[model samples]
Target chain A: MDFFIQQIIQGIAMGSLYGLIAIGYVLIYNAWGVLNFAQGDMVMIGAFAILVTHIFWGLPIIPAFVVAIIICAIVGYFVELTSFRPLINSSNTRRLIATIGVGIFLRNLVRVIFGADPYPFPSIFGNTPVKIGELTIIPQNIWNTVIGFVLVFLLTVFLNNTRLGKSMRATAQDREAARLMGINVKQSMSLTFIIASVLGGFAGMLISPVYFVIPTLGTSLGNKGFSSALLGGITSNPGSMIGGITLGILEATSTNFSTSIQASVAYIVLFIVLIFLPNGLLGKKESRKV
Target chain B: MTLFNKVYKATRIWILLAVALTLPYWVPNNYYLQIFCLGMIFAILTLSLNILSGMTGLFSVGFIAFFGIGAYTSAILTTKLGFPVPLAMFLAGVLSSILSLTLSLPTMRLKGMYFAVATLAFGEIMYQLFLNWTAVTEGTKGIKGIPALELFGTSFRSYSKFYYVILVILILIIMLARNLISSRTGRAMLSIRENDIAAEAVGVNVPQYKMISFLISTFFAGIAGALYAHMVRYVSPESFVNAESAAVLAMMVVGGIGSIPGAIVGGIGLTVLPEFMRFLGNIRMVLYGASIVLIVIFAPRGLGGLIERIDNILSGKQSLGVQKKQQHIEGEE
Candidate 1:
């Protein structure tokens, strides 16, 4: 029972990280109908930004994070201006491939600057464990869970109640209809990118302490987040969150069996989910108008 | 086709064939021959991928996994089972085509992006299998000392000899691809790419064509993989990573999607050009990524489009506007 509880806690922590990245994915995908494959790279860049500020410049952790997120937003804007805006009228495949280029460029640029070694990330929660009776918990894991839920709740509310969020959703639903409704579709789309980048940056910051800072940090994590978003149904926020947690938990539990099982759990589960629940666990059935 | 066109085409083919056959002599060393072999191998890969991605419009990011499957299959057969290389390569392609069914069938109902992600999942799973299935794959240590090419009492143990084998295979595959693309089945596949629903409504059997496309593409990918395995005399999970898959896609795009000549040009150009840029050191990949973006933005039709324009000019025809208008109509479809 104790081991199971430990696994659950670990899963929740990791799932939250995946969830944050998924939210970014869902946002950009919704706004532009293009899966920004670079979203993962953005997360990696965000973490690197924090590394520069907090470690190199020796800024306080809070200021470092804030500055890093702003840098991420700026990067996101340029990403939109360059890779996306030029190809707006092109096919989705073209746009997606362009994003892939952006991802590779950013990753290599970071490698050029930082070299290809993993750096130790300083943990914000410090190296301490909280004890309760016979059970022990890492302070970082607990904070991660709490912060993850809070952000998800806040985002759900924001998307549900805010005007900008509503406009973003409108653009996602039907770009033409959204334009007809007098929405600044272009501006809305850029804002969607910035917000998504912020989320990606935040995910990066959150996971850095746990995963370390590396040039190739985003590849596997991005893949996991992508799978999470798909498993939850790319169209739904809550679904993405649930999907991440489920995937994380699955990975944690599977670790006991074999390393191979742990590594493959997310993909195998994603494959099964995609096959059986094409609409996703929380996604609506798509209606086509001929 | 006109008599002039026929004469021009025949002359071009003969000249290209003559150049290809005599390449090893004028080349400086075995190193250049090896690189040419590698380029031809990748050309085979890009061409096969084009059958699905370029012509059929299936955006499989996991296509390289099939290549890996073919390589490992051939390696195991030749090394462990003591089978000949040709027989092993054939079986490798057959196995990959069959395995492609497992992926294509379940994801048949998925839309473009979803299908892509599903294939991505399929790729990661395959990578894991290659990494962990140590019994067959030999794990991360990789399989080494595979047998070389020997057929009909001729030994292709040398690089120049091997080059002929690859060139012959590549030309045969290209001919097969060209013939297939100009056929009724190819037309049906193109229609599906333009719009699957519309094609289905018109009785094109969308799922069947998609399956056929997958089978055909993966079959060749497997063959290319077998070729690569034999060429290198080694097999490792590292050779078939997702990045390599992306590189092949870049080749298809750089040459021009949906163009046979484009795939060949893109494949060879991407492979050969990178070797020349070894002086750039670490920044090579960064430039590579940037080039893909620039090409997508500025040269959407890629080198294939440029080649067509050149061809038209040489043939005393004006086709620039006609080409653009055709593409526009196709986009509408």
Candidate 2:
């Protein structure tokens, strides 16, 4: 029973990380209808930024985290300007491919700069286990979950209450309509990318201590994040959060039974969900007007 | 329409074929020959992918999964089961086609991005299976020392000999693809690409045609993989990573999404481009990513389309129908 509780707690922590990453995916996807395949790479870049500032340059943890988020946000802006903006009128496949190209570029660039070695990340939260009855939870895990939920709450409030967020939503709903309504559609798109990148960077910084910082870290995690987003509802923030948590719990439970299939669990779940429910768990059924 | 034009068109194919047939002789250096051989192998894979993605308009990013399956099947068959090379290669294609059928049947209902994601998941799943099923795949250690391809008691132990074998196979595959593209089934595929609803309205069995296109494409990919396995005499999970699939997709995009000649040119150009970029070392991948982004943004029509346009302009034969066809292709995207 203790082991089960521990696994669930671990799952929630990991799922929160996934949720944070998935929110990034949701933001970009909701705005531009382009799945940013580089979302995971953004996370990797964030972790590396923290590594440079805190570990290498000897900055404090909080300052390093803020710098990392800013760095990633800048990268997100550039990604939109260079890759997304130019191909605005292009096909979805082309846009997706461009993002993929950016991912490859970012990953290779990191490898060239940092070399191909994994680095141990300095944990922001000290390595202490908090015990509740027979259950033991790592401080990092608690921090991860708390931060994840808080961000989700803040984002939800922003989207529902803020003018910029409403404008972004308007653009997502209908670009032409939003443009006619005097909304800066392009600016909204850029803002969405920036926001997504910051979230991705935050998720990276939060999880780095557990997964370590590696060049190719984002490839699989990004895919899983993508899966989580798709599973919840690509366009729904709450859906993605729920989806990530569900997947994390399932993954944890599955790991208990067999370790060999751990690598493929997310993909397998994605395949099953896509086959059975193409719109995802929380996605609305879209009607096509021929 | 003119006699001179007719004669020029008729002779052009022969001229191209002669040059291709005698390429190995002209480039007798084993190192360059090896590069050309690798290019031809990729050409087969790209061409096959073009059948589904370019011609049929099913953009699958997981074709590498089929390639990997084919390579592994042939390797396991020949090395473990002691089967003949030819038999193993043939069975490899068959098995890959079967796998493609199973995967596509369930997921073909998905449109566009959903379909791509499903296929990507399938590819990742297959890769995991390859990595984790250590008892069969030997885990990360990879399977090595597979025997070379043998035909008529003549082993293609040398790169030059292997070059001819791959060349012959490529030629046959090209001919098959060309024939199919010009056939009624090809028209059906084009219609599906343009609009599957319209195709269905016209009594085309959309799902069935998609299945057939997918099957044919995977069959060719499997053959390319088998050839690759025998040519390299090794099999490993590393060679079939998702990045490989992306690379192949990059080839198709740069070549010209819907153009056959484009696929050939793109595959060969990309295959050889990396070798030339060796001086750049790790920067090559960065450049590769930049090139893909730049190409997609600037020349969405691709290198092949650009060449075709230039040719039409230079020959003073820019026809309205050709322009209309190009527009239609772009519109389908």
Top model number, DockQ = 2
Instruction: Quote the positional error of residue B224 for candidate 1 in Å.
Output: 0.2
lDDT of 1 by residue, B1-333 (tens): 466765776587787789999998998998877887898899999999989987788888888899999999999999999999999999999999999999999999987788888898898899989999999999899999989889999877888988988888889889988988899889888888888888888899899999999999999999999999999999999998887888888888888887788888998898988788889999998998898899989988878888877776545464445554434222221
Model 2: CA > 4 A from native: B1-10, B313-328, B331-333
Say which docking band candidate 1 falls in.
Answer: medium
Query: How high is the TM-score of chain A in each model?
Result: 0.97, 0.98
What is the C-alpha interface RMSD of model 1?
2.1
Give the CA lDDT, 0 to 100, for residue A229 in model 2. Answer: 94
lDDT per residue as tens, model 2, A131-166: 888888899989999999999999989988999999
Put down candidate 1 lDDT per residue, A103-189, tens digits, no spaces: 999999999999999998988888788888777899888888788889889887877799988888888888999999999999989
In order, the Cα lDDT scores of the candidates are 0.87, 0.88
| Native-structure RMSD, model 2 | 2.3
